[model samples]
Target chain A: MGDNMSELLNVKNLKTYFFTKYGTVKAVDGVSFKVDKGETFGIVGESGCGKSITALSIMRLVPDPPGRIVGGEIVLEGEDILKISDNEMRKVRGKKISMILQDPMTSLNPVFTIGIQLEEAIKIHQGLKGRSLRERAIELLEMVQISSAAVRYKNWPHQLSGGMRQRVIGAISVSSEPRLLIADEPTTALDATIQVQFLRLLRELQEKTGVGLVFITHDFGIIARMCQRAAVMYAGRIVETGSVRDLFDNPSHPYTAALMRSLPKLEEKVERLASIEGQPPPLNDDIQGCRFAERCTVAEHQCRLSYPDETEISDGHFVSCWKF
Target chain B: MQRYIVIRFIQTVITLLILSIVIFTLVRMSGDPVLLMLPETATEEDYELMKSQLGLNKPVYQQYLIFLFDAVKGDFGKSIRTRKPVILSIKETLPNSIKLVTVAFVIGFALSIPLGIVAAVKKGTVWDNMARVVTGLGQSIPTFWVGLMLLQIFVVWLRILPASGMDTWQHYVMPATCLGIFLMSGVARLLRSSMLDVLDSEFVKMARIKGVRESVVIWKHALRNSLLSVVSFGGMYIAIMVTGAILVETVFAWPGFGRLAYAAIVNQDFPLIQGVVLTAGAVVMSANFFTDILYAYLDPRIRVQV
Candidate 1:
């Protein structure tokens, strides 16, 4: 363990690439971040910006053949998970690190009972079974705020509402009481009202369990509501990283500035919301420079020539830009 | 669930009734059985006598009514060629046919599903390619040819097993294997595609994230969901095997309902043919009913919606 051994999960320079027939897809290129104990670290980016892939890579559950985690270390607690064997990694997953994926409607196995699915992690990690497992499953269901947990445990996934199913997923992920929980757009499929409630529930659960969370999403609104620290990801690279308040008040990177400008304001009235122009550059080969340079409003010749290194702006704020 | 079963049951009855009518009329329309049974040099007197004796003198509608009435009472009348009760002979041979088909179904599923899952898990690899080639051959080559080949190798050349008869379990090997080969390929292909679809589903990925072992993820989660298609396909395959037993029965000389039906068809035994058709129809209908129930149970959405 290092000086910041308290950091529950540290993903250092993670590089996950997809070797497809049409060339390589640099899904998560040298993405680096750390989620401290009991902290919510948000990774905000557009759909193809590799937020989910980063989460998957950390879990060591990335689909192979086309995708591979080519480099970098995923250090959880103390051990570097990337260096461990798959069998050992399986022990790490759900026990120390668990993930709640996107699309709650299809996340749980449809053929299995809610109880069986909830009990799966508990049984695997805790070795509880029979009456105790049943009790644990009921407790987990109730923990997620599902009414009549006993009855609901026997229900199939298709019988549950989207919100309820997502809660069940939350319950399953937390069953092992993992130190770090990576939630990849857990509430994206939920209704707006339900999303708030779910997020609040997650936040409360995290507070109660003291579990670190890697909240990955595209919505800045959710990032503001949930995250303590936030990173703005652009084309698989974290362009800016700081406390939510610092990032919101004074974003350093151009991409972060553009993102803040594009967000809909509550107090201010405008004819149209500001949107960053230009599509993100194709992440096929090794990118030479800042990915946002092409889309940047104030791009310089130096920005296009080569990639900029991360610069510490303040005590906790870091930005990657030549302009800084 | 009860309501669904009841509704399906009624539907099955209606379907069976329709099938019986079709079989009766179609078999009758194949031409006069008496004409076919009698010699070509038979006089008009012989034709009239045979017609009167066989109740061919009655109108078609009367004959259908008589047939339906007898069918309702579990009596399919006497066989035109054998002069024995049609139902009695069918009842005697039905178990053998059931046995053969059941064996085939078991063997097919036992081999196919695992192979399919393995192929799906190891997609695009040597195991997958080999599975594709083997299953493709199973489906493409004729069943009779396969049976003959097995017989030539196992029975004729090696002289290790009996070629025909159902007296010993050894006799069931060639016919069952031949029958199973066809179904095995179909089941493998179907299960492979279905397993691929299910393995690609979000639930499977979520299961892996839950720290579920790879075997549990594949066999428990992926396999269970994938089985919906396999089970349905299997039900249809069973019904097909029951009816398609004719060719296999003839080739192996297995004394099943299929062999009896084959003989009936050649000898113009209308009552016997009708009995076999009616039995086949019932088997198909029941299989469909069970499959629907199984499907609904597997998918709660279907259980609630339909």
Candidate 2:
């Protein structure tokens, strides 16, 4: 774990559930992680593995009626945000911690110009208005490396290319210099070339602002390149957590090992890529044993009887598995 | 943008031209206007003189050509029953219809927008169900029945309002409410579904993530997008209110364009009928044209394409 003094975000045993008509979906169950200032904490998982839900939980943005954070302590800069009133929570959202969502195409309001959207965040958090607000918005655009910032400001979201819109979204997220920024699959919709450029921009922005980032994505390559510390999740739980280097070199959990093996290796000439067999168990049903026990190879009877506890294998590496 | 407007204008002209042809043919087919003009005691000579004088003795195609030529110059001929110019009759009664429709539209829009937004935001709550039931009843109930019931309650029972005529603002209350109820229900239902879709959209989620006040999120962000469908439907509804309020007009005894058209049709007044139908068609087309322009303004994607 990162030192307490430098920690910017600490999420402890967060459980976010969805109460549908049929049953309760334990989407994010007992997940915990921490992010330090100027550090990137990567959350890597497949679709429906609660990576996105965990981020939404941090922002208190889980859609209600069906979804709710049932149990959680989201401590940000020594304060537990879960205990705050909605008004105060609203203040915490943009000013203290902001989020950049996936799909730049749909992330921005189509009716508004990019400048107005950017200026909106600035106005709300920084309290700048009139000429100064406009200038600051243009400056933020320039900082995001959008050329012809003054003219582009007038362009709507539809007028910009996918990459440019993502940049604008990034600019909006960091406009307030938030202590933490949760980027939920921000580049999934971008073209491959644009994806590389966007990741680089994120890194540069983090270095400049020294803001902690909770980077959420399914791509291992992104986790390797962008994250300092990474957590592998499966069935709404963190299966493993360690330094990115340690995770890549020595995957502790069976699910983590399988995911690593499934990634196409450039050095190996193989006809078929490795794939994990079987789907994740339905979340609505209560499971007594380890959630991944069904798909995990070398699982003993004990693995199916009860969930395993996290065991530290190295100084900062931890894994939850019967073998550990 | 200028080009787009010019295109829409041309389209409106074409639409009105087609409508005029339909109205001309349909009105002429409805028993001869000459017979209606002549008294029962008049001889055949009287009918023949009236027919030739009114140019009904000409071939159908030739009569249409003359009608078209005169119509292009803004002349719709004189009414068979009243001997007043058809255009003048419309000019007189059109303002009353405009007033009623405007009042109805304002009330309907004012009530429906908030109702729809509240219903959608608090979906599955008591407010949502209440909105649903109210709008459902508004849509399902017959307009004339609603008007008569309102008259019975407000005028006969409560004695708070006038029963008929456009004599006072009190007379307008029941009629406008009756007309506006249908519009309100339709727009509210449309806006509710639209708000539902928009509330679930990524932009709305992003707005909330920005820590915008919940009110701002619902009112400014969600409301703007949801209003697109409402504006389109409301525009068409306004056209309907202008020309299709005959039943309400009859029930309330309001001397509007709809009532004028009803009387012209009953009297088999060809020129007046043509005038009314053509005018109604023009109103409908122009409403649609303006709606398209407003739609473009509200949605940038459409503006770019145009």
Candidate 3:
């Protein structure tokens, strides 16, 4: 975690399946990515596009019975996490890489105070005790710019405003100062003003603590604001990856192109925002060709028959469509 | 939280009033305790005199009002069957009933939390499936039948325990097993669903991704959240055991109020029946009232959602 050349977090060929009554739903299939030190990496896609599922797989937070991580490798700092025991995995969870969930509303325990929950995470990770723990929790609260940290720190989750709760969640995540922070749709539930404040605060924190961040979201505006690099997912695969600027300015994949166009631009007054037609493919579909082929603007005969492999278009830019 | 408490208290009071009216009316309607108390030589005049003295000759509403009044003053009428103070009768035997119910509650809570957790955590695994089957059986079978079967096995055949009475810890095994079986299964099934739901919550997943200890995740985040449902069932079960204890108390002939009240009811003993029924109403009401306060205490959302 302290060293530079060493990868902070590396995931390879991750596959998570849900064995339901109907069939095995491949929620996350053959996904791979890496988060470097102190940089914000974002995964952007439409709903049910496996963006969130990829994050869940990385955390191994999949529910058992129906949900299982069938195959994959989760390499965290030279160690294969998937090979580790559940007991050991739990020990590594809070101390190494902490996660902030999608909805701050349901993420905190209803019974506990924000301070108590934050302290619980701190106590377990830092082994802080008694008065020291309280002080540490207050310090963490203040770090997130929560006003009256001393007073509001003692209040329960419901007592605090929604933005304040998200801030408390941020405080808890950074409490241990882990090298990696997995923020799954961290600002989705917040208003635009709060969302901007939160994202800016997160970027500041990442820089200050030098913690790598994995931001998962369906909102491209969020990716544009927060991420240095972005990966575009469609159906259950990473279809494109590059700098956020590159992806936004020149989206190679047709789906990515459609997504960029669909988002309303603040600079221009257009007749209408371009929209991608048709719903997401069914969970059970084999997806022999490109998943976006049905909605792709330039769908060739080959695009409907076989899935085009990822072709590197630039130094780091990668796109999956078989186009120039 | 304050609003929730006020509403819950009002609801509990209304429930108790309705329960009081129904029990008071029915106990008197069963007829004269003296008819079953006296011999065939005792004429209709004898019954009339006894009914008049006991206030049974008055309207049912009047009897209920007097009973509710005396109940607040700690003046439960004398037991017609035993010819002793009703309060003394309850005082002498209520400890036995409390001890039994307490022991049974501890056992049921202990067994059910783990059973429910295992069922939820494992889902379709053998242990989970086995728990589901066991709970289903528990819900379908009567507590008395379960008690009888346990008695036959543990006391009747093996002689490992005494089958009846509140005399020794050994004597309690059959009765506690009987009382605990139904609740344990019902609570376990409830906890299973609740645990699964809690396990899926963002907090639980957040705990997992933190690399927090499994025990910590459960006890702090997942288990506490899961216990909210258990709190609800806890309130309901207290009321159930209050009523169920009467039957169990009489079955074992533990000399508790249950047997005395049952006998009085059979004989139509107005004083004793009124006392026991009213006391039972208070216990159930207070239990429900306390549980509502606890619900508000445990979850602030209960207040917010209201």
Residue pairs clashing in model 1 are: none
Task: List the candidate 3 regions with Cα displacement exceeding 4 Å.
Answer: A1-7, A267-271, B1-65, B79-82, B300-306
Candidate 1 per-residue lDDT, tens place, B1-306, comes to 877888888999999889978988897888888887789999999999999887779998888888788888889888877789999998899899899988988888899988999999999999999999999999999888898898899988999999889999998898999899889999999999999999999999988988889998998999888988888775688676875698899889998988998998888687788888898788888898899899878877677664
Candidate with the larger TM-score of 1 and 2: 2
Please report how far candidate 2 places residue A67 from its true position, in Å.
1.0
Give fnat for candidates 1, 2 and onward, in order: 0.81, 0.74, 0.84
- Error (Å) of candidate 3 at residue A206 is 1.5
lDDT of candidate 3 over B246-288, digit per residue (tens): 6776666656656666776787667777777777777768887
**Leading candidate by DockQ:** 2
lDDT of each: 0.90, 0.90, 0.81
Name the runs in model 2 displaced over 4 angstroms: B29-62
Per-candidate clashes, comma-separated = 0, 0, 5
* Every candidate's TM-score, chain A alone: 0.98, 0.99, 0.95
TM-score of each: 0.95, 0.96, 0.90
Candidate 2 residue-wise lDDT, A1-324, digit = tens: 347899899999999999998899999999988888889999999999999999999999999978999997999999999999989999998889999999999999999999999999999988999999999999999999999999999999998999999999999999999999999999999999999999999999999999999999999999999999999999899999999998999998999999999999999999999998899999988998899989988899999998898899998899989897
Minimum summed lDDT over a 10-residue window in model 3 chain B is located at: B252-261
lDDT of 1 by residue, A109-165 (tens): 988888988888899999997999999999988988999999999998989999999
